[model samples]
Target chain A: VSLNLAFEEAPLRGSISFISQSGTLGNYLMLLARAKGYSFRAFVSSGNQAVLEATDFLEYFGQDEGTKAIILYLEGLQDASRFAKVVRNIVPQKPILIYKAGRFDVGVRAALSHTASIAGNDRIFDSFCQQVGLIRCYDPLHTFDMAVALTTQPLPKGKRVAIISGGGGYCVTMAEAACAWGLEVPTLDYATAQKIKEILHPFAPFPLNPVDAASDVRPMTYARVIDILMGLDYIDGVFMMIPFMFEFQLRSAAAIRELVDATEIICGLPAKYGKPILGNMIPRVSVGPALDLFQKAGIPFFATQDESARAMSGLVRYAQIISLAKEVPFSAEKPRFPRADQPIAYVSRVDPVNIPERD
Target chain B: VSLNLAFEEAPLRGSISFISQSGTLGNYLMLLARAKGYSFRAFVSSGNQAVLEATDFLEYFGQDEGTKAIILYLEGLQDASRFAKVVRNIVPQKPILIYKAGRFDVGVRAALSHTASIAGNDRIFDSFCQQVGLIRCYDPLHTFDMAVALTTQPLPKGKRVAIISGGGGYCVTMAEAACAWGLEVPTLDYATAQKIKEILHPFAPFPLNPVDAASDVRPMTYARVIDILMGLDYIDGVFMMIPFMFEFQLRSAAAIRELVDATEIICGLPAKYGKPILGNMIPRVSVGPALDLFQKAGIPFFATQDESARAMSGLVRYAQIISLAKEVPFSAEKPRFPRADQPIAYVSRVDPVNIPERD
Candidate 1:
């Protein structure tokens, strides 16, 4: 078979490069990336992996200056030791985010049908990622979110967050979600409370950490609430839920765009002060309006507030990890192909003897 | 086939009645409702309209007196005139809110395949609903929102709305949405603005209509914002977007509920002075913890701010029709089977003429 080596000069200089054994998963991820507006260095469908291996590409991407992160959508490992070594080498220079599919019986079945290959146990891969400093993204959205967070906000010193909103429930949800994500929500001091009281309502109460404003208020309340929350001593970040003004109209497309742009600008302001602003402004009302705003602004806004908050949690956790430890890069190793004499069993584990006896 | 009529018994009073063509959609709605601590009056699947039709069940609920409101998951009409007639008949005596499914082509296909029936054009259904008194809900969430709105709040007199929020974008969106929905957002006078400024920020320009509190200085900010906006002239309703508070801290759930309840009490205070609370209080946060508080206090809280606003819009539109029209009841017509003995020939519009026309 003849093939074109497309890259002649400065090969692997640009784009996100992903190697996956399952083409269906690769296609799904590609579609998701396109929908979420994620830029890729390259996405290669590594079918069979009989010749070119995953480690070969990892090593190549490890030194490639253009590649900021390498994401893997793995069904199973061809060689576990080589995989760990390659990821270790890449970590010091760039982040290695791993998403291992085929972890369950159903996933294994799907992978078998898609790639005609058997999946191995996931515990080994999970341990390998943890040891090699790979940032594992549980979902596709989270993968993009981590990429955006690393590319945007500076890693936080700690996980202490304060939520400010026009509604109390939203603030509480944010606080609860933050705590669930290992962040803290401390009470404000009397002095801080008094300062906030000057600008807020007397009945509104001071130290309203997650300020929940009423419905009859104007949009300016969010800006003020955010300012007050950011002023707090313990707050490392802010998660606010903003409304899509145009969605309420549901009429003019122009109105929705304007709302999205203005929303993006206002929400993006917190980042100007170097404070992480995790906003829940899902364009679930209409997908077309604020999608470009999210993509262009490099924010992880989704179609649901829950999704936005969850993505924020992922980024927050990954940010904390990067702050705690330095990851290693893959060692310089030569590629190894499977010997022709050895049988390459596709249904490697489903055989009778290999089946685990479970209670 | 003998079927149990236990769902029709008087003992099942005060429970939710669910009717849907798609079992999955029905199941999802049921799950959401159950999660919200609501019990069902009856959960019936109106399969293909070949047996028990939507009109039949709606009419039964209308006169039953046990059903607070009749909810429907409609895909298409088996008989348009019969459905319209039945809806108009039951609407005034009972609120029939519908979660119409086939809004888009994909939705139509899904509806069709799910029920093994053709979902008629959505445009026709939209026009038919407008002609009659049917309340159209955007999604499953909004179906519940509209139901709560009708059950809790009194019928609004006019389209004038008062929007309260903590964010600029949220307020603007609310204002634009209100305007688009043909609701009036009356500007606040200088006096009201001045009083509000005493409690709000200097830069928090009370854009007259959307009462922007501008900051989360305290929980009192919540009451003050509502008070100022409600006092404005010509404002008949209010739509508020509260922050997600409880999601952040479970300990703060009571505090958050107190904050909302206090706001509602303040809103009710206007009624003591003869200016009745005309609008709705839609807290944008989810009702996971504060559901009991909201239900008992009489403030309609919605999970999403968008859904809340949309429900208010629906209520406003509904009130307009109610004022101009009479109450409608469900149809008494029954589905008639086709002729017992007839040649079933496949007919085509392209060949309208028979052999008598040409050959």
Candidate 2:
């Protein structure tokens, strides 16, 4: 039996596919994805696995023409060796992201009862996932965060990221986070710095690696600087930290709209130049409308600098993996597994007994 | 002049106080605090430091009878030694939480321009904060999260926390997070497990420390278990992971309301029994009304288990500090500093130019 509910009428079609073991988790994922403006090509809920297992769906998606990336929510493994073999065969072809649930002792017991499968040694699973080129996510929210970035943005060619911020504090914070996430913030060349200085206000400080465009809210100033930075060969991606609330305080709604338009212009450069351009805007009620404009335009606006940095880092890491995979020779070998004519059973019957509702 | 705006008319009166260096940061904090149902006794914006520095507000709040907890957003320090003295004196009496911006090179430069104050050596500042028993939060959101927990709940006397959840995966995830966040998730005793087993369905597994209340939606079962667990002398606090979204899907709106009411009953027990009970309900639009009910009752419901565990761990750590402070003899000494009669400049004139409003 299958259980399905669509939150939106028209879901965006994409190359990312998700296979969830629990239907409840699948529902939550779908809700979260819709709220964050994420699109998916397909989602398969592998409930009970009465006939088909998680690896079965994984193998299917690996060869699917429409699927570019595969995400899995795994509780436990019925056949570890078989799963490992399947992952190794697929890793070279597509990116595999997994979120393994049962890690602790209590969790292992709970997973057994919930899924009727034994959770293997977590450390061993970690080693296996790393060996097979799987991206492991700690939390559900982060999993979706990386998935959205992977699907929407172009992969970074290298770890060098240029940060542009209208606020100084954000530049400092984003720079620290970028370093921590293994992305390098290289200093701008004197020639590039000189070009940016010409566009900025006279009082503004000399442009640095984290081009702190402080107090310069003019849309074109940002658009021009970003366009110049992205055109440089050394810069792989750009992280534009836009303080929407701060802008709202300093400027009017019309000015904020202009800033949003400016952001759209910068975001569009990623597609034109083939380098990722990520956006960060702190959530504020006063700037809700402006934030909506970015979302409606399909720009990935991260809520925190750390989150934005991590997403960019993930893109760079995946790009490196893809580069390495191109040099490695692989043999295609399918693992034998029990297969059923129908993988999903759609049970239309809902539980009739309702608990007494509270007023 | 102060730009003041109140988002909620009837704000909760509490012992928490916040002192911010930037007025813009203060406005954003206030908006976030309101959205998260956080309340404060007073908030001071130490703008420009024209006369009053951050330390002056610290000294004032240190002596204020109404203030039990103090939070500071420091961009720079004018008098490090004087600030250190005030913090040491206040730490013994109340928890002092600080979010120091400009830790990195770029942040330091930004801090200088933003407030015209020298951002000191971060390593020295870190050492000073640790020496004075100060709680250093990394971001603005975390600072508010901890403040809410400190204001609403009783202090956790020990690190042992019992996690109860309806989903096995959440139970496992929370258990792992609790352990990592320095809170111990101990195994349940035989008698306690037996008592819990009597309430759960026979199909459900035997009760464990991270009690997987799987397939059980009866609110009374949770209330009864929580009441029993909190009464135990061994248990210090309870981190209840109630996935209200899951319940919303399984039951009608009325049923979810009953679940919320049940949460209220459980939350009420913490104050009666003198044990801290923290709640975790993932932010979902479907369960917004139910989540609102918990907020109205002044219960701290966290969005993730990691966040919930971290806040609970902070409470335990602060309680430990308070306990240690009681035994140590503290000498009362005030640091010397320059004094000015007029500490604040209230600029009455508003800038006449208005940016045109957007359509």
Q: List runs of model 2 lying over 4 Å from the truth.
A: A1-15, A29-34, A37-43, A243-264, A284-298, A331-359, B1-16, B22-50, B63-68, B102-118, B243-264, B284-293, B331-359
On TM-score, the leading prediction is 2
Positional deviation of A96 in candidate 2, in angstroms? Answer: 2.3
lDDT tens per residue, model 1, A1-359: 11112222111222455655444335444544544444556666565578876677778778776667666665556777777776655665566666655444433433443344556665554444545667654343346555545554544545566655543334433454444334556666677667766665554534446554432134444555567676665776777665433235335666554555455665575566566766554232334444555455554444333344445554554554454344222233422111112111122111111111112
How much is the lDDT of residue B12 in candidate 2? 52
How well is each residue in B1-359 modelled by candidate 1, as lDDT tens digits? 11113223121223346676554335445545543334456666675667788788777777765566678877666877777777777766666777665544434443443344466666566545555656665445556656666655656666667766554334543454344334556666778767776776666654455665553435567566676666555766677654424344244657666666665655464454333232322223334433454455455554333345555666665565565454332333421111112111111110100111111
Worst 10 residues of 1 chain A by lDDT: A348-357
CAPRI-wise, candidate 2 is incorrect
lDDT of each: 0.51, 0.68
State which candidate has the highest lDDT.
2
